[model samples]
Target: MKAVGTSESHADAVAICLTQADYKGHLCEGLYQLKTYVDEVEYGGCDKDAVPTILKESPVCAWVDGNNGLGVIVANFSMNLAIQKAKKCGIGWVVAKRSNNYGIAGMYSLKALDAGFLGLSFSNATPLVAPSRALEGALGANPISVAAPATNEDYFLLDMSTATVAHGKVEILGRKKLPVPTEWANPVTGALTPLGGSDPSSNYKGFGLAMFVEILCGILGDSGYGPYVRRYGDVHQAANIGHCFIAVNPNYFAPGFEERLSDLMNYIRNMQPADPERPVIVPGDFERQHMSTVDHQGGICYAKDLVKICQMLADRLNVTHLSPLI
Candidate 1:
């Protein structure tokens, strides 16, 4: 496939360096992720050396073994399979096992959106969430994402974690040396609060949702569940994480799905908000606005510390260092 946007070398360098610096992990562990992909593909992971194997298949559904390969590549393969099936059967469902962290869940779902289909993606993660009434972490901040196309090249994309907040947010706070809100997480204890906080009535909803993801991505996929999954950042053993992808062809059921979707989205945007200062917005408004600003600025704006870290990584890897634009 012809590449668009940033090249892999540039993008992976920035991503690894930033994640290592902000998340405060061993630099080698971060760099090892890229090596892992190459090793799995060229060595022994996939059936055809980096290519996933179909464990079971049907007209509209299939199960794939990632062969302990890189999560991103395996996820792309799974989603493409789902999209191809949906093109023929009007709907397609695919699940994968023995994968690793695949970065943003929305990326996979957006693949379907690019193919002019509704997309849904889900994945189980390393356990970091403390279920309601629990004292320790048991469930992961499993993520769910859905994307649907709209008229005029717009889209409605919702990508979020089941937890009250993603661990990456906490990592960002830590990098800035800021304390988190009590409802967000307990830094000292390392216990993340559920989506609804400590209240049993509402918190159970998040707890339930987390379990729902576990069932779909873990239990259903026959991969590890909850605490059974390897610890985050542990690269020694195979992560064996599970993921689910689904694609639905809106044209199969309705002739004007995009029109109705666009209308509803427009209506929601126009709705009045009780807090006028914080205007009511839809799931994808912030991302669209932010993307527009980035486009106007010419490129991404990285923090000074992140730039320094990337420079150090460049020196260590003997690659071209990144220069600041502003």
Candidate 2:
């Protein structure tokens, strides 16, 4: 199939690769993810040669088989399919099995916003989260994202993992030589705390949400569930990850959806802050602000070490090294 968004330009690939590299470094996950993708492509784990197929379809629902293809490409195709179905039936829900990691979940949700529809994206990942009372990791971070368009090209986007904190955050702490918060994880055992930490009352809520995502993405999609899924960077086996995408057109349900959403978001932003210096902000504000800064700078900035890693990746892949734009 054709490239996901626009032209199949080498520039697009370079930008994405560099952006992911920057994200890996900033997120403090090191270059393992970039290496994983490169190794997957080289080993045929992410079968760029294979094509995604629709296993079943209806006016408002569909099931897709990613054939262990690249997650970004497969996810884009799935969301586009949902958008088309929503345009015709007022709503669309699509699920895919045998997929790989699809990077950021918000990217898929924003795709629906771009089409003037509210969108939700969910995916099951390698197990990293333990149940409230459990010590072993039984659930993945299991991220969920939703995006709704508002007036003035604004959007309400919430993308978060069901866990108390993503595994990457722990890695970040480790990289900085900082002590992990007791509520975040058990440093000795390496078991992650749920969204509400070890508290029985709230931790269960996070565990529940994680299970909810697993139900939709894994069980519903007929893919591996919980620990059944392979380790993320294991190239010997297919990831067999699952994803779910949904799109809803506001026109089908209510009028003035965008206006009302914008009004509420603005109200929230204008709310009295307990700390006046740090104003109350709604979800997606930080990301939007960061994007603005990056746009002004013309490109993403990365640490010197990350640049070196990217240069090494370029050498390994025989691609041009990324040059500093700033």
TM-score of each: 0.84, 0.89
Model 1 poorest ten-residue lDDT run:
20-29
Predict model 1's lDDT versus the native: 0.75
lDDT of 1 at 71: 72
List model 1 lDDT by residue over 1-326, tens digit each. 00113345434533644343223222222333443333333334422224567899898999998877567667888999999999999999999988877766777788999999999999998888889878678888888889999999988988777889877667667789998887877555777878887655488888888999899889988887999987765556677889999999999996999999999999998899989887778877876666666677875666666567656655655667766687
lDDT of 2: 0.80
Candidate 1 residue spans exceeding 4 A from truth: 1-49
Candidate 2 collision pairs: 164-195
State candidate 1's TM-score.
0.84
In order, candidate lDDTs are 0.75, 0.80
